[model samples]
Target: MVAIPQRTKGIEVTRADDATTTEDFRRQRIAEAAQRARAEAEARRAAADAGNPPRPREINGRDGPEPVRYGDWEVGGLATDF
Candidate 1:
């Protein structure tokens, strides 16, 4: 009669049988996500810079301040020059 061995935790498992291809799949997924993020950022930057410069706001009878746009974000009334 033959006895079968029981499997236990912390025991080393060997993959000397069928070949596994898990590592290749994981790397492909990470690369795809990075590419998508880069494309989106590029599009936002183009849109922000395409339009005419924003007009400056008029303060108490003085020339208005110009608003600054940075990649889909905007800041108004800034004293520092861009």
Candidate 2:
């Protein structure tokens, strides 16, 4: 009986650090955006509480200016039929 030791040649094992970095970057970017949105909303609410409100800019998707709504306001604006 003869014993032979064999090794695999030219088989490359790679660590995909690039993929990990890309996914991590995307996650961090999304988290940053969410945090910024939350901060902005909090600031706006505080301003409203102080009797100073903000208005939307004309650059938005709407064709014209929209009233800044606060505290249980309806999206359909003021309702009629009183």
Candidate 3:
């Protein structure tokens, strides 16, 4: 049987190694892209939720900061009621 040349064998091995490295790099890029997309989606969802400011509710002609009920009542802010 005829034997392959040493140079050809070396080239083949090098090509196989390069292919594996290229595949690994491609996979890593895909994973990074997917992670970035997920982060962007979450950020967009958060931004959408934050887009519209909440309309303040008024009770007894009081503004947003003032709790409607002064007795153990609370709103978005800390409880000023005692």
Candidate 4:
């Protein structure tokens, strides 16, 4: 009969200092999202000032805004919520 090992090798234990709590992670994510939004807004404003309007973002696998469908109703093309 073959003998089995009691403990596995290379098992890593995370240190308390290296671990992030759920609350901390949530706050970090929120901050990142807000930063991205602000940056996009600033870019749009800059483009407008330069007389070059920002192109519509790709939606529904198309180059420009397409009609968004909600249940039986066809909503407006600009689907920003996605």
Candidate 5:
């Protein structure tokens, strides 16, 4: 006759321990990802506000150079909204 082994208390304890470890690891990974995302956002913001002078770029293939728009369009050196 085939015999089936009965579940032991030690097995349950080990399983519980593993579950706790997995949860902790998951939380740590999530926190790290959030931190990285925040850092990337800050870097993007800094680059955008780097104070570099705007250069004129052609808009819609217009014949003349269109002002390099930063925030608002500069028409005759005066800031105007589109």
Candidate 6:
């Protein structure tokens, strides 16, 4: 029987004619091509967003002063009784 040779992970490999099927190799190639296409599309989107400025939001409610809280809790102590 004839033998087929394939290189994987920097190693030389050899398999018999029936050992590896054409469908297995085709699936691997299709998956790799899909990954490359997705990566390229993402790069294009990032470049476009960087060039555009951020838009401002509209406020429909009345504006008022907001309350601020500072350090009201004690440190290294629990409020719950055992």
**Candidate that scores best on lDDT:** 3
Tens-digit lDDT string for candidate 1 (1-82): 2444433342332442211333444567778998999999998888887875876765553233333433322336444434
lDDT of the candidates, in the order given: 0.52, 0.56, 0.63, 0.57, 0.62, 0.59
Q: Model 4: per-residue lDDT, tens digit, 1-82?
A: 3443332133232444423554466678789999999999999988888997666766555334343553322235543444
TM-scores, each model vs. reference: 0.39, 0.42, 0.43, 0.39, 0.44, 0.46
Q: Supply candidate 5's per-residue lDDT for 25.
A: 69
Candidates arranged by lDDT, highest first: 3, 5, 6, 4, 2, 1
What are the root-mean-square deviations of the candidates from the true structure over C-alphas? 10.6, 14.2, 10.7, 13.9, 11.4, 12.8
What lDDT does candidate 2 reach at residue 58?
A: 50
Of candidates 6 and 1, the better by TM-score: 6
Worst 10 residues of 1 by lDDT: 10-19
In candidate 2, stretches whose alpha carbon ends up further than 4 angstroms from where it belongs are 1-16, 52-82
Q: What RMSD value applies to candidate 2?
A: 14.2
27-70, model 6: which lDDT tens digit per residue?
78889999999999999999999998886653663233321234
Model 5 score (lDDT): 0.62
Better of 2 and 4 by TM-score: 2
lDDT for model 3, please: 0.63
Which candidate would rank higher by TM-score, 3 or 4? 3
Identify the runs in model 4 with alpha carbons over 4 angstroms from their true place: 1-20, 52-82
Q: How close is candidate 4 to the true structure, as a TM-score?
A: 0.39
In candidate 5, the residue pairs with backbone N, CA or C atoms under 3 Å apart (3 or more residues apart, or in different chains) clash, namely none
Clashing residue pairs, backbone N/CA/C < 3 A, model 1: 56-65, 57-64, 57-65, 58-64
